[model samples]
Target: MNLEARKIEFVQEFLKLQSEEAISRLEKILRNEKKMSENRLVEPMTQDELNNRIDQLESDFQNNRFKSSAELLAKYE
Candidate 1:
């Protein structure tokens, strides 16, 4: 009923899965979950140029001329 109980039920059902298709789906889910979790683990910036771009963004925000997230993202396309 609750989130933790649902997670436990999911784990129990997952452990009981015997079909190859079910296993494959579970493996894909686990791999994607691991990739997402790894992205949450931050790596230090080793590039000075990349750091300066971040600093420029900070300066732009302070100057009230920074574009919105949607506008900034659209430029890449």
Candidate 2:
């Protein structure tokens, strides 16, 4: 069958699932699959885009928009 048909078939079969353990396992698998798909959808920036991002970060740093690593760690301790 085609993708949509298979998806509908999966939905029909999934609706027939009754065991709590089976459903919980399926839920975990679906969450991991979604995270993986989202990561795959992210496109890498070009060289000019990367340079602009670095320039913005440098400006933010110079304007005191960042914190030191030691200061950040001290808050948790």
Candidate maximizing lDDT: 2
Predictions: Cα RMSD each = 9.4, 3.8
For candidate 2, lDDT tens digit of each residue in 1-77?
89999999999999999999999999999999999999999999999999999999999999999989999999999
The TM-scores, one per candidate, come to 0.49, 0.60
Candidates' lDDT values, in order? 0.91, 0.97
* Per-candidate clash tally: 0, 0
RMSD of 2: 3.8
| Candidate 1 backbone collisions, by pair | none
10 residues in a row with least lDDT, candidate 2: 18-27
lDDT, candidate 1, 1-77, per-residue tens? 99999999998998898899989988999999999999989787779978998899889999997788899889997
